[model samples]
Target: MRSETREASKNVLGSPLRACCHNPQTGYFRDGYCRASEGDMGRHIVCAEMTDDFLAFTKSQGNDLSTPNPDYNFPGLRAGDRWCLCARRWQEAWKHNRAPKVVLEACHESTLEIIPLSVLKQFAIQAMN
Candidate 1:
């Protein structure tokens, strides 16, 4: 028997969190949402739209998001793919001028602890009306 549970999480907008990506089945739990648990040290909660520069930057950092890993079920990422990334890594990318656009509605509120909302807003893919 198997069961699935979702955390009562909120997005950066203080609203109910939304799914980030489904094509790659993102999230720390691989459930398409950017929720994180206490044990999730990586804090994979920042929902970012991939870019060529960002992918190359991350790969240089040794994460290698573009390489397919069958053992882990990772089908490799390409530009335009939406992924739940580590908050700190995103900040690092920002510092290097390679940060990808972020989806505020899909980013977990906990990400605020690592990256400021103002910074995230600067790279938001959509403007809040």
Candidate 2:
């Protein structure tokens, strides 16, 4: 059986939502949606509010999230930007105290499988009410 995280059929807690602004490239499928499917192994499920510190830290770890790369269709990232990030990567950042804030409405519930809800709640920016 597939993991619950891998079986997320819709955006967490809401309808299909746009996780990122597409002026530049974003999203696992590059469709600007954070929805996951059977083919998505990295589990790009968290809609994180990008920050300079997290971006720089990710870059230092060799991900280079800030540099635009045409070959991979990556238009690059910037502070205050929104993007779908892998659950594992986000949790890893949290482990190191580099995890950025998150948009709860945009974040996939699959994230809860890897990270605690209370932890995510601590970084939440979007209001549920």
Candidate 3:
């Protein structure tokens, strides 16, 4: 049932969006997906499970869980809404890289059909730095 729903969503969403981050100093490519909202930009279809690592990371960053949802400029994200595991991990990875800045230039959504683990690894490395 879940797989069916995912497939249905994939069909409707067209495909995941992709973005690349390049280090100006070394011209390294850091690729990843840009999370997007579904349905009139009012709802996010991504589901994440909170984990210990995520809790610790958010705690360390001083992100108060008690606060209202942040104004992400996206429709459905409300303060206090917890991120799914994937989103949490994505954020942590971005933070670890300290990539100076992550530049997300849009790419064909179909081009990002598969999650780029390599790009994620690179992001992690940057975050760790």
lDDT (Cα atoms) of all candidates against the true structure = 0.88, 0.73, 0.29
Tell me how far the alpha carbon of residue 94 in candidate 2 is from the true structure, in angstroms, after superposition. 0.7
Q: What TM-score does model 3 achieve against the real structure?
A: 0.28
Give candidate 1 regions above 4 Å deviation: 1-7, 127-129
Model 2 scores a TM of 0.81
Top lDDT: which candidate number? 1
The per-residue C-alpha lDDT of model 3 at residue 75 equals 27
- CA error at residue 57 for candidate 2, angstroms: 1.0
- Relative to the true structure, candidate 1 reaches a TM of 0.92
Instruction: Write model 2 residue lDDT over 1-129, tens digit each, in one string.
Output: 243332344445554443554555456677665666557898887888889999988888878889988898777889988888988989989999999998776666666778887898889887222
Once fitted onto the true fold, the runs of candidate 2 whose alpha carbons sit more than 4 angstroms away are 1-18, 127-129
Model 2 worst lDDT window (10 residues) = 1-10
TM-score of each: 0.92, 0.81, 0.28
- Two-way lDDT contest, 2 vs 3, winner: 2
lDDT of 3 by residue, 1-129 (tens): 121222223311255332222111110111222234332121222222224454445556765333344473222323222332233334444467422122222222221333343453342211111
For candidate 1, write residues 1-129 as lDDT tens digits. Answer: 122245578889998888899889998889998787776788898999999999999999999999999999999999999999999999999999999999999898888988989999999886222
The best candidate in terms of TM-score: 1
Error of 1 at 111 (Å): 0.7
The local lDDT score (0 to 100) that residue 119 gets in candidate 2 is: 90
